[model samples]
Target: MTLLSLFTQARTYLKHRPYPVLLMAATPGSSFAALPGAQAPTRGTGTSFLQTFQNYAFDGFTLIGLCLCAFGIILVGRHALGVYHEIHMGKAKWADLGSTAVVGVCLIGVTIYLVTTASNIL
Candidate 1:
């Protein structure tokens, strides 16, 4: 198969599971984990009902970011599993598998780099 076709297939797969991509792209405060400890907020300070509500509302971004990161990880894992299954079923060539593996490794590496480097600028 042509490289274009392979990309088209990947696009189709992503289209069918758009949430992961969306989450990865749009998660709010996702870089909080990479912030300096002093810059990060402490938990459990708000005890009053209104204070609690405000805290939850603002802190929800961090929670969403965390969830999105988890979802993205699961999605990558599923993609790898799908590729492996295709190779096992003889539906994909060995070269395709090798290329896919390389791409997967690069993807994971980039993801790690992004998560590790994400900070105020991000």
Candidate 2:
């Protein structure tokens, strides 16, 4: 089978098994323990609700970044599972390639967003 076939299969699998796949993808965040003393620096700054909202919007961008990265990793894992199935059947070699390439593209987009952050000083 061609590389395109593998990608097609991966896409079909993702489309059909979205719930379990998404659940597995989200599982990693479960192990992330909250750190102590991680409160905002402005907690006692006596800011109004509006100021607090603005601070959360700014600081919360990191959360968005983390979610995007997690999504990409999940996609890669889903694709790997498909490849594993195909391998056991003694079929195509390109099945996993398509899923991994798409994952690479996702990583590139996430990297671009991270690098272009408004607060990036470096």
Q: What's the lDDT for all of these models?
A: 0.69, 0.69
Model 2 RMSD to the real structure?
Answer: 20.1
**Separate clash counts for every candidate:** 0, 0
lDDT by residue (53-115, candidate 2, tens digit) is 666665677567667667766776776777777877888477466766677677767666774
Which 10-residue span in candidate 1 carries the lowest summed lDDT?
36-45
Error of 1 at 94 (Å): 2.9
Clash count, candidate 2: 0
Clashes by residue pair, model 1: none
What TM-score goes with each of the models? 0.43, 0.43
